[model samples]
Target: MSETQNFIILGGSGAGLGVAHSFLKHIEPELRKLGKKYHLYIIDSSSHFFWNTGSPRSVVSAALLPAEKLFAPIADGFKSYDSSLYTVIHGTAVSWDVGGRTVTVELANDQNTQTTLPYYALVLATGTRTPSPATSLHGDHTITKAAIEDLNKKFASAVSVIVSGGGPTGVEVAGEAGHFLNGSAGWFSSRPSNPKAKVTLVTNRDKLLPVLSKPRALTAEIYLNQVGVDVVYNVSVVSSTTDADGKTTVHLSNGEQWTADVYIPAWGITPNSSYAPADLKNDQGYIKTNHATLRAEAAGPRVYVAGDVGDYSRGGFHNLYATIPVIVANIKRDLLEAATSSDGSDSQPNEPDRLFTPNNSETQAVPIGPRGVGAVNGWGLPSFLIWLVKGRDYMIRNVSATVNGNMV
Candidate 1:
């Protein structure tokens, strides 16, 4: 209905889609019971929803599945919803006016016309921007696929492969390369001296998986080294130059230079909060939200944020999962109060906003090739369980179901 409240969602990746799915699964039912009507506008730069957790493995090993599987249409996630209430806009939000409750988005095309959309409530799920394999921020799936194909080709011919960043992404990428090039009966071991790709991992941290415990970190490095990945720690790549012949000379901060055929930056996080109000953001440009309520610390219209874009002390898929339900609950509460307040003659008392307490517990699974390592909370897990839980398909199948609106 034209009179219905417009609840706009920004971003369509893991955190964004999580909120969208929650709206359809939880918020819609409550609204129906209250005889309320609302519209969900999901605006994203990318038309397709990318499974970020599986991206690193997918780019390094495209043979695992089709490119289409890596990136699926965002609309497919809301197949069960009524088309009238769900609107998917593929564009970039360039400006916003919290005072006016309107956001201007620059459409993705040569024209680049700026279109303004007014909203009753807003959910900022834009998240952070990172290089491909960790995350694709450009929102162009075609370009991402093409880049992946090119990388695969380079991997095939590269003699020395350099992966910078020892985070989960870099660790996994190095592992995939090792497995692909030197697995059982692999080219590296098969030829033994044919000058196959020598995979090297460089990180500024003292150890891999810096967030994990010492035992888990050491185990991860041991596993990767077991698979033929040269793990270099306490060193970061300062700059790299690729020659005409495709040979890359990588200069490290330690004043050491190494030559490689392929270089991949699988680290770093750049927040995507340009469209957010400055007062609601932190020094790092990430939106500041109440730890319990997941509500933006603002005095104007009610605003909420989640995912990498939110300034949580620790960031990961685990944090996103913990905050999604809280955000949904708070939104539903606001909507209910607003609906009831409309019928009041003189005045309606405001209801207290629900606070969301995030669970600080952490869990990580990093698989290198067939065998991997992981930790749940502070306890270390076996390699078999790591592979079983995530290494099998990098949880792509499960994430796909989530994207498709399946219960799993």
Candidate 2:
């Protein structure tokens, strides 16, 4: 390894950006003291970073602000420290050469250029991708970009739409689609009138937001019903097929068939780990890591995995809140080390004993439509105050200001 170590981070979403910010804050001073410069590079395929919280809202109204408005350009954001020390590449990592300590990345340009970056340390913060909806037996197709686009196109022309899946994403999609349908009449009043669209939400779970507490789940159900969405529960999708007229027919396990112009699958997401090495992954293909150290289980040293890509064995919601700080701490420790003293001192710091499990208070607040459902310890609370605090604006403006160095 060179005296000046290079850090290559994969994925440029919430986890990746959070890791970058944490690295700059935690490790820069130590590197400066050592008279060494640390180089940081981030690889992501998209030019713009999408706020996950804003995705559902964007799909509904197509009113999401531009990528520039959401995230600061990675290069510019790191330039103040040292432009040469940090670089952002628009590329997709096709494979990793673990033995050679290199990653092969395919650039997004037409030339189809490929480059291998050698890293002393690699941080895998790549988040999950939307699952393919076609093969989802549970009828979860509403979360992906393609599925959302298809739903919008169908809803614009059809009279009815059915959304399957009862999770946060599913409920959000169903509600948003319902709102879109209700507004389409006004949006196209001057144009040729289209038939009114109806939205039905189906879930195999007994109640909407089943992960939430009873009161909160009931509140969510009531709110969804108020918005003209038919909430059906305890039903499973046995099969789905499209007819000649382009309408989708869904067969229920209970022996019922319902046809709709558009059927949205909004099941859930699996971690994106195809780029990761097989030995480093768990049975589900999620990278396995030491939660306290954030080090890859199979990697001997100087390699870490963070964010949704890592399997903490606790839960799947390993994003900005839980994993980023640990990644930062581990990276800082690796990058800053004192020379061996004349007494032949051991270089590694005493491993700080820490618990890796999530606290009971660690809960995610999910917003259904404009209203928010605050979940604490996996218990949901029916409160519009939570929505006002974080949901109403979708935190886009705040994140934008933070990244772009501008007030929203």
Top of the candidates by TM-score? 1
Residue-wise C-alpha lDDT for candidate 1, range 32-96, written one tens digit per residue:
77777878898988788777677667666568644556778888778777888789988888888
Best by lDDT: 1
lDDT of 1 at 93: 88
Candidates in order, TM-scores: namely 0.91, 0.80
Task: Pick out the ten consecutive residues of candidate 2 with the lowest summed lDDT.
Answer: 134-143
Score candidate 1 by TM-score against the native.
Answer: 0.91
The residue-by-residue lDDT of candidate 2 on 1-408, one tens digit each, is 226667888877666777776676667656766576678888876655555555555555444322223334445555556566678887778888888888888886743789988887788877675543322211112224454455445656777778788877777767666655654224324211442577788889898765567677777765565455678889877778998877999898789999998776666567767777789888888888887677884765577876767887343343346665566766665555432223422256455523355554536566655555657676555568767865566677655543432321
Evaluated at residue 199, the lDDT of candidate 2 is 76
Per-model root-mean-square deviation over C-alphas: 3.2, 6.1
Stretches of candidate 1 exceeding 4 Å from the true structure: 32-35, 184-195, 342-353
